[model samples]
Target: MKKIETIHAVGHVLCHDVTQIIKDKTKGPVFRKGHIVTEEDIPVLLSVGKDHLYVWEKNENMLHENEAAEILFDLCRSEGMKGSEIKEGKIEVIADRDGLLKIDRKKLFAVNSLSEMMIASRHGDFPVKKGDKIAGTRIIPLVIEKEKMERAKEAAEGGPIFRILPFHKKKTAIVTTGNEVFYGRIKDTFGPVVKEKIAEYPTEFLGQTLVDDQKEHIQEAILHYIDEGAELVLCTGGMSVDPDDCTPGAIAGTGAQVITYGAPVLPGAMLLLAYYEKDGKKIPIVGLPGCVMYAKRTVFDLVLPRLMADDPVTFEELAALGEGGLCLNCGVCTFPNCGFGKGVVY
Candidate 1:
């Protein structure tokens, strides 16, 4: 840092804040630290009693905080995301559209391990709305070594550390499997509940199909939906281990690759996920447990956004949810805002 006359400080970066004093109106920083001195700022500085200023000396080997913040932003920005304007040595990553947020945990950890820099973000694999602040980045010091930033770039070599997969419109069908409903013994409450939940996404409901708890009947209904160009098929009820439960077997009978018939999460432990590939397109077929029919927030809430965004859920990823999968079932539910299924932090 070097001392220079306020008049000559134009284009230089201030090393410290310049405070202003008013008799009764205000007394605060007139110019914050790291502010670049401009010709128009000279008069304001002099009025604030700053005859001279301490400014950071320009160096070819070093990057100013704002410059370093841009580099960090570059490492995290991806489609469906935008960076906030640099301010106070910081930049925020904001969602440009509603989508599912995905982060490369390993690469994020590697970059954050570097000295004098940081990147803080919301948990990945969750829903994010447009204009939401997803992540923030900045440099700790006023200036950072250029070499260090280069290493950060290398750490995030493959692609941006953060991504937002926009939701895709899908033609969806629901098959409610239960003899109680098919035989008109009970109201078809589950189908209505499933429809209400899926209504929040960009899906075209292809109407509900009622099937008795018979493996062949269930299989026929599921195949019928797929043949109708349904991109997603949901089977509600008949997911338990009871002898009459036939939804799981019916889904497998359709020759779909069942990813998992069980999960570590409660209220959804009996959930089944499978995919049927035909003509190069993989259609998802999910068997939802009874809990989703009545519970305020279940495993369905955690996985629905990813599915709607066309992001496939892997077995390993589902296994990681065991840590924070149990929902408190609060009287007033605040799902994604709460930590119901955000356990596996890398």
Candidate 2:
């Protein structure tokens, strides 16, 4: 590495090893604020003369490099904070409750590690809207390199805002279809059981229709809800290979693409998925096997959140869901936020 030097001046200067300030010699040096001259660099610094030996450092500023970057990530990527590029060295962040904060370029270069300098928003939940103040970041000590500050400022620019409208509450439609249930011989115990499990949500009554060993009618009813804006359509019973068990057949008739007819999961192995586009919006239809009625957890436990989310369900997404899709069927069921389908960043 090319060694540079500066001479002693009227004021003290801060000097740290070149390797400490710069990760790679290729990247060059970044001096933080409030630094003072040291004897280690005295030989080099002396060559530059007294006045030129002055080191860049200060106390009060909007943000230091590392601190500013951390704050920007928390706001832009994690907390959905809004910011605008004012200039090469300037970024302006405005919060509804916290007011406005200005980020200076010089301050960013004054800090070490970006993680130390960044500030995240207070909000932790997803679906953050615009203008939310996730966190506040600022650099201490003023003087810093122009390029290094620019790099830090650029990272704080913009990021994804996982926002979705809560206009429609999640409502489930339960359809129980089987020749036995239609004949009214064993009593429809499955319908009530499925209802009890999802009772946490404000599930609306979408009518329980009894179909006699017919997949056509089952598929027709599923399509009816898709047209009527049903977020989830659950088909109970008739998921087996028996000719009379036509629930899978009914789901196939909907003209919607089915991601999986069955999964490797237990209890709900017979679960199926069919998706259709209704006016450009993707509609997800789930075929719940008879096991779901009795089993504590099933594939239903896994795909519910993704279905409720305002996003289209794809084969890749469904396949990825299989990892945590199996239910341990623990002594008790802690649903909605369970290990089966832990939350994923959208």
Candidate 3:
């Protein structure tokens, strides 16, 4: 790149995007790279306080910022994701499908540690929608050493820095227990709520069995769903310590690996989570507390997306939810978008 007086820069290409900042009113690029400066543009350029300008010039050792940015973009593109067009030496990574985003954070830090380059992304393990901006990368200079970009590539050698895990279709079975609903004393609210939540994913409630608060009946109903090919078993109600509440134990009686019997998040603390693995098949069993039937959002809302994506939850992971677990229960609840059960940093 070469520096020249703005008056004498006519016909010369602007080497970089010149952003015009008008206090808080506006701040955006008015002159883009490769744009030929004209005599008419002199006043506009001077108005933006550009007395001197950087013009494009070829150099073997130094690489143009656009070329350098694409190299950084290539380092972040994985399957199920694509990149936006290079804009002012920056390219944004976007999700090609709606799914959970997984980031190679350790390698990401290693790459950023290399000078003159950066890769910024959203937090890992979060849900994302198609066309969502996942990350953005740029070369930190108008021009940079070719070797530095190559070094950044070496630092992120494990493939792309991130990938999207698309949600899988699962055949789910919901078993709502409690004598009040089983005997028609109260309407079955939990069953409809679970159905509505899982409907957001590529899943279907194959069936729902309404059983009384009897351990034997609840156990039998759950096993029947598994034998009928239910990949996800959902048990609602009867999760608390009440003598009549028996869903949590019924789920355990199936000989499943119970991950956690209680959660830290508000609105769903009594929730039970477990996994049944046999003959190479793993089915997740959840015993949702009664709070789920009332709260608009809870731990169930937070973990449901991950489970639908076929991402198994570890006991350690559930324990990490305490930090961002408390729900504000705002007047107008906006879950998933709100911080309710967002989980904390480890």
Candidate 4:
């Protein structure tokens, strides 16, 4: 840092804040630290009693906080994201569209581990709306060593650390499997609940098929829907381990690769996920447990957004959810905003 006359400080970065005092109205920083001195700012500095200013000395080996912030922004910006204008050595990553947010946790951790720089973000693997603030980046010092920023870049080498996967419109079909519903013994309440939940996404409902608990009947209905150009199929009921519960077997009989039949999550532990491959296309098929029909939030809520974005869920990822799988079932039910499914995988 070097001292320079306020008049000659134009185009230089302020090393410290210049406070302004008013008789009774206000007394605060007229110019914050890291503010670039401009010709228009000179009069304000003078009125604030700053005859001279301490400014950061320009150096090739050191980077101003704003410059370092740009570097951090580059590490996070992706196709569906935008960066806020730099201010006070900080830049914010914002979503350009509604989608599922994915974060490379390992790389995010490594870069933040580097002292003097930080990238704070919302939880990953969840839905984010347009214009949402996804993350923020900044450096601790007024200026940082250029070499340290280079290491940060290397730590996040593969690509941007954050990405938004936009939801895709899907032609979806529902298979309601239960003898009581098929035989008109009980009201089909589950189908209505599933429809309401899926309505949050872009979907074209292809009608619901009611089937008895017979494995062959359930399998036939699933195949019929796929043959009818359904991009996604949801089967409700018969997910338990009872002798008559044959939804899981029916889904397996359809030749879809089952990702997982059970999760470590409450109200959704019996969930089944699978994908059917045909003509170079993979269509998703899900078997939802009973809890999804009555519970305010369940494992289904945790995985639906990801599925809507066409992001695949793995067994390991589902296993990691065990840490935060138990929903408290709050009276207000603020999910995703709650800790129900926010366990750290790394």
Give Cα-based local distance difference scores for all models.
0.90, 0.54, 0.87, 0.92
In model 4, pairs of residues that clash are: none
Which 10 consecutive residues of model 3 have the lowest summed lDDT?
336-345
Per-residue lDDT of candidate 4, residues 1-346 (tens digit): 6789999999998887788888999888888887899899999899878999989998999988888889899999999899998876899999999999999998999998998999999999999999999998888888899999999999999459999999999999999999999999999999999999999999999999999989999999999999999999999999999999999999999999999999989979999999999899889899999999999889998988888898988889998999999998888977778899997674
Q: How close is every model to the real structure, measured as TM-score?
A: 0.91, 0.57, 0.87, 0.92
* Local lDDT at 345 for model 1: 41
Candidate 4 residue-pair clash tally: 0
Q: Rank the candidates by lDDT, best first.
A: 4, 1, 3, 2
Worst 10 residues of 4 by lDDT: 337-346
Query: Stretches of candidate 2 above 4 Å error?
Result: 1-56, 59-70, 73-157, 161-167, 170-172, 224-231, 332-338, 342-346
Report the alpha-carbon TM-score of model 4 versus the true structure: 0.92
| lDDT of candidate 1 over 194-263, digit per residue (tens) | 9998999999999899999999999999999999999999999899999999999999999999999998
Task: Give the lDDT of residue 181 in candidate 1.
Answer: 96
How many clashes does each candidate structure show, in the order listed? Answer: 0, 36, 0, 0
lDDT of 3 at 54: 97
Candidates sorted by TM-score, best first? 4, 1, 3, 2
Off by over 4 Å in 3: 6-12, 19-30, 36-51
Report the C-alpha displacement of residue 6, candidate 2, in angstroms. Answer: 27
**Which 10 residues in a row give candidate 2 its minimum summed lDDT?**
97-106
Question: Against the hidden true structure, what lDDT does model 4 obtain?
Answer: 0.92
